[model samples]
Target: MVPTMVLVADGTRDTRRKEALHDLAEAVADRREAPVQAAFGSPTELRAAVESIEGPLVVVPAFLAGSDAASTELLAGLDLDSRFDACATAPLGAVPSIVAQLVTRLHAEGWRPGDGVVLAADGGPELPGNSERRQVIDVARMLSRRVQTPVQVGYLHAWAPSVSDAVARLRRNGHDRVAVATWQLVDGADLHRLREIGATAVTAPFGPSPVVIDTLLAQHRAATARLAA
Candidate 1:
């Protein structure tokens, strides 16, 4: 039986964010020619989809991993639901192509040397690994190394060095053009706030990008193959 794919994301009431998730699901559905559902922060929807599955079920985390408050918690609840046999894939942030996507977006937006770059993210997992949250910071470093420029970090919700502060610091550092590499899969209040803060430019979120959709599909296919095994 062909496994139905479920894309799980950090749920939000924002219409644009919801639409972004649906759009991504539709794109992957079209390419894989398979049934796919987007359960954005809805345990009821996820359970319903799982309980109704005819075959194997594959859960793909559409948001970045290490977001314990979001993806991790959601997955934990799935373990408790136990409505069906399911195979899951790491969150989209685990995809190695993500770095490439960031670099591509940076260059596409006409970023150049002497311009400041900030990896503006929602927040990091609080449970501990490194107090400073290594996931987003590591990503920032990866972006920095690839672009051959220093990359600053700004957390939208939780931690310090807010995107606003990062932008301000860049201004003080003599960077007239500051670009924020928004580390989100969908557009919502966070993106809106990042935009309002006076960054010279903000790279688009990953949602509608083909690279993201393709990576999601790859993750689903891999999980499906695992279930078959």
Candidate 2:
């Protein structure tokens, strides 16, 4: 029997959101050996899609991992209806494996264990006062503690000391050649901006590694397996 799999995500940006959704869907389909349907829309639209679908639903955030107000809103809306058994997986940015990939990227970029580095994210304080920007800080703190480097949280848009600002600060503090690890899933505007600032840019493991496909596939398989259990 073929299990029903519905891939849904918050579709704010017409291009990037759609690409992330389908990229995830294709990855899931390839792994589950089942048919997967993709849905791209706002939170309201996603809730409606879930209500209409007869199979298991996996809601994946296009943004990095960690919970935010918008994500909380979506989850709250879903909780209003208990007709379906659904589970929201971690955002692509929060997967534990992502940390490992990031460490590898840093090492490859010549960042030793004690090198002062900044894990810069595109998220800013601008999205909303309670956006997921804090996740960046959380990740940076965790990584910094693990690697024994001083990592400070900053944003590219909504927060203080943007990546460039952070870079300048690091340089002024005598840490030259600061490695700017991009917390983006795919290469786009933010990546371009990082390059423009002359920061030594490094993408998250998913952005340049094939393991991203494997991770998406595993997420879907886990979702389906849970439903079956």
Candidate 3:
């Protein structure tokens, strides 16, 4: 079957963000053993590609949270039409493999067992759904368990306990060294904010990692399996 992978992201005017997304798409396609075309854009743009492509398609929302309004809206918009054979899996943040990738990233950054870590994301009043924030907290908890360190949740925007605040809280709690694990897909204002937060170390976003690519392919396979069933 001719299968296409549609990576849905929030529409951004930033050229860097677009380039990063394009790079990620290319990496995923390269790793895919079968003939797979990768398309990156908003829901409408992805839908156009899906309609034009012959055969089945699987949409993997590149969003970190299952509750992301943009991704949810995109999926909803696509669900309205049944003209194309398409299936969308859960967001990347919901995948268990992300926890492993987070741990790997932290260890690569020289994170010690006792170092306090903060999971930072662009969370605030502007984004819809507390679910996204909750997912970030869940990831923090998972990381805490993996590394045996205290991991806290921090926001770059409209949420309480900003990245700096979380770092301060960790310092006040008697942890001298603190690090930040960015919960983002690409470099943006959130990443910049994370860097300025004064953490001892800050891990980059999970951009086109092998684990991420595997998770995305798994999502596609699961959707395709369901379609076959």
Choose the strongest candidate by lDDT.
1
Which structure is stronger by lDDT: 1 or 3? Answer: 1
Of 1 and 2, the candidate ahead on lDDT is 1
Query: lDDT at 211 for candidate 1?
Result: 81
Candidate 2 error regions (>4 Å)? 1-5, 12-17, 33-35, 43-48, 66-82, 92-94, 110-115, 124-134, 208-229
Off by over 4 Å in 3: 34-39, 66-77, 124-130
- Quote the positional error of residue 156 for candidate 1 in Å: 0.3
TM-score against truth, every candidate: 0.87, 0.72, 0.85
What's the count of clashing pairs in each model shown?
A: 0, 4, 1
lDDT of 1 by residue, 1-229 (tens): 7777888876655778778778877878888646787787667767776676666778887776533246555655676245345777766553458878987888888888778999887765465332336677778888888888899988776678888999899889988999999888776667788889888888888776788877877887787787777
Q: CA lDDT of each candidate?
A: 0.75, 0.60, 0.73
lDDT of 3 by residue, 105-178 (tens): 88888888889998887664433343666677777778788888778887766677878999999999998999
Task: Output the lDDT of residue 99, model 1.
Answer: 78
Ten-residue stretch with the least lDDT total in model 2 = 66-75
Candidate 3 Cα deviation (angstroms), residue 169:
1.3
Candidate number of the best TM-score: 1
Angstrom error at residue 69, model 1: 4.8
The total of clashing pairs for model 3 equals 1
- Using TM-score as the yardstick, the better of models 2 and 3 is 3
